[model samples]
Target: MKTTKILLAGMTALLLASCGTHKTLMEQKPAPGDTPRPAADSTSHKLSYVQHISDKALYQKNVVSNLTFTVNNGRKDITVPGILRMRKDEVVRLQLLIPILRSEIGRIEFTKDYVLFIDRIHKQYVKAGYNDVAFLRDNGISFYTLQALFWNQLFIPRQQRVSEADMSQFSVDTHRLEVDGSAKIVLRDGKMTYKWVIPALWDQIAHTAVSYTSPTHGTSELSWFYEDFRPFGSKQFPASQSVEIHTPAIGQRPAKTLKASFELDGFSDAGDWEPFTTPSDKYKKVSVEEILGKLMNF
Candidate 1:
């Protein structure tokens, strides 16, 4: 009986050890400060600092915003301000306030399938299919123009790989952290040729600055300022942001300066952001020249 009891006690201890080991493994969470995936990986895009920044320090509560932007088309200078009202599931109402011909231009809307532009002054509208918005062929990738659309498919974590700094030409530092189940990335890079600062604070770009040498542009540089961070529902970012891109206009003695600011001053529940839809009856078949004149308001 004594020998049998010893074997039973040993078996019971072994079983308990196995159970404890399983429980520990189940409780394990992803470690903080893990690096974002590489840039070449299609499933791991979006460089962030979620591994470095502390979430408890950056949770913004109850904030909405308006964005004001300035654009210099070389021939004319303009300021455009946009407002975003947030809703559940990251849906939002984006309103663009444009200043044109010394007047406040009407709002433009963007939906999943189309781009809508409305001329409040002329009571006319311009509609472009998502496919027609491309200036070139359907390459499936756009560097800048697509910046207008901040889609989760385009900017979300793990959607694409993050680019690495060429340490031979530049130095880099990155930090990441997790907060509220989201990732954040902060990066800084510099070299003898140029310098840039990207603060992926709380997975949102807090600020960015870039400078480089150009033979024609003559050492062009741009700086982006982000502030007034507010949270709309679950989304959080700057309520107002500004960008300045400067270059030397050929005839202008000093470099011409282009400054743009976007502010999300106010937002409301606009339901779904349907791209502006233009009615077919509003457009009449006309000659190319006539269409050009109409577009130019001639």
Candidate 2:
């Protein structure tokens, strides 16, 4: 009887080992490689509380001030002292500096689809559709969403825009857990690749690196470093934020890098989040053809 019991125990151990091996194999994911993109599901995944935390963190009641760095050749930096005021599905205004013109871009206004650039110097305007903003074949004042940092805002988060996909379109992998407490998601759509890195921490995303790539433009890396989170009125604000841009081998041109810094000092959400109206006589609205004609000057 004792011999029979011992045999039974041995058999049980073997069964357990086999089961464990099977589970291990199932859990193993392939090393990132060039896998064919699969179709995405029509339905989007519901974001959990943790995922929403990043967005909630961005909806501060107070204003935000930060220094952003764009590093291309060395470090081209810009510092802006302004309040980050937003009205839910309404508008976002970044009172920042316009490097090309060498003056303040008083208010960068964005609605649901169109992005309007109001020049503080000449009081002229440049407009572009949201999707066309990425078709950066030429130079002009265009607007891109800085909304990924906030949750409860987008139906599908910006970080999830790129779809490498599984058998379904929504397939994704967590890229990195940010020091600021945001999670980064990586997705690929055709030749264009997208990256979404949201603020992970409360009121600050410190020392985080996010990248986006495409076949034509190559790759661009954006790094953010947070400094202070001081209370403005009823909410917390970032005292300073820095950004760096690196593009690898665009055309035959050696890789270009741009560094910009945004420094926010006194912030007040007192004024209306209205679009800045430029002086009609300041500058003429140039066409894409005209901008392209000046490539040699760039």
Candidate 3:
């Protein structure tokens, strides 16, 4: 009886963990003992921080990679081989296959305003505006937020356009937590903090953690840890990533958690990232209402 209860609790935590979802310019408030600097000098210090980050930003036109994906949703764990092609601010496409069977099982594509989910095994497909999905709409999920998480880019919330980013709103801090000889570098603005734990030289971050709360979304947290970054042109991309998301326990549902790990087998930054077009007669079409009903019922 005791063991069963513990197991149930563990499962609940795992289920709650499932969910998904940067910039640096910095200012350092000088210590009181420090001499006051000229206004222009202060401005230079503030601007200097952003320049450092811009140097590391990997804002790509497109990227293509083959990744081995492993995921667990509290109930079961699944491993599959997959492909990801991402075009910054535009679209992201993913294709997943069943390991040994070599059968394509699922594909998902996200655009600026829409999401398309295809279940090849069921011959079912869903294409809808982002707001059409109940879970996403209810939780205030946006395409750009997920895109940032996938693309390994720093993100600002509720900023419909990326150009709206305000450099003054953020500050950089190099001294923080440390582990395994790596220290965390943090960029923070109000309630949101973008953090990366990296080596002493601080050239790249081994992990990134972002967390924020909204009136409609409660608390949503995300983390991506990268290792063995691979080379592409002048930039480097992590060959492996550990991803996590946690949604606050709200309403009737328990707090949910989703965890996934990915290791790259191949990568490229140029290609035709065409999305899969569903055949008119190939799959049964369903309404957004039905999809919501199915998820809620499950």
Q: RMSD of model 2, in Å?
A: 20.7
Model 1 ranges with Cα > 4 A deviation: 1-82, 85-104, 109-116, 123-171, 174-204, 210-222, 250-255, 266-270, 279-298
The digit string of per-residue lDDT tens for model 3 on 1-298 reads 3332222223222222222331221222222233211133354554454444434557567888886877756566656787778877778777776667666666667788776766666677767886765545544557776666665555555554334246555444423322233344455655566665444444555567776666765867777766666677777676777676776777787876666677786788775756445535878876656654454432
Question: Please, what is the TM-score per model?
Answer: 0.42, 0.53, 0.71
Query: What is the C-alpha lDDT profile of model 1 across 70-166, one tens digit per residue?
Result: 4443444454555554332222234444434233344444444444444443445555444553311122322222232221111211112222331
User: Which runs in model 2 stand beyond 4 Å of their true positions?
Assistant: 1-49, 58-85, 96-107, 120-123, 134-144, 149-204, 207-209, 215-217, 232-235, 271-282, 288-298
Supply candidate 1's per-residue lDDT for 73.
31
Ten-residue region with minimum lDDT total, candidate 3: 22-31
The candidate maximizing TM-score is 3
- Candidate 3 steric clashes: 11
Q: What CA root-mean-square deviation does each model show from the true structure?
A: 23.3, 20.7, 8.5
Q: In terms of TM-score, how similar is model 3 to the real structure?
A: 0.71
Clashes of each: 34, 39, 11
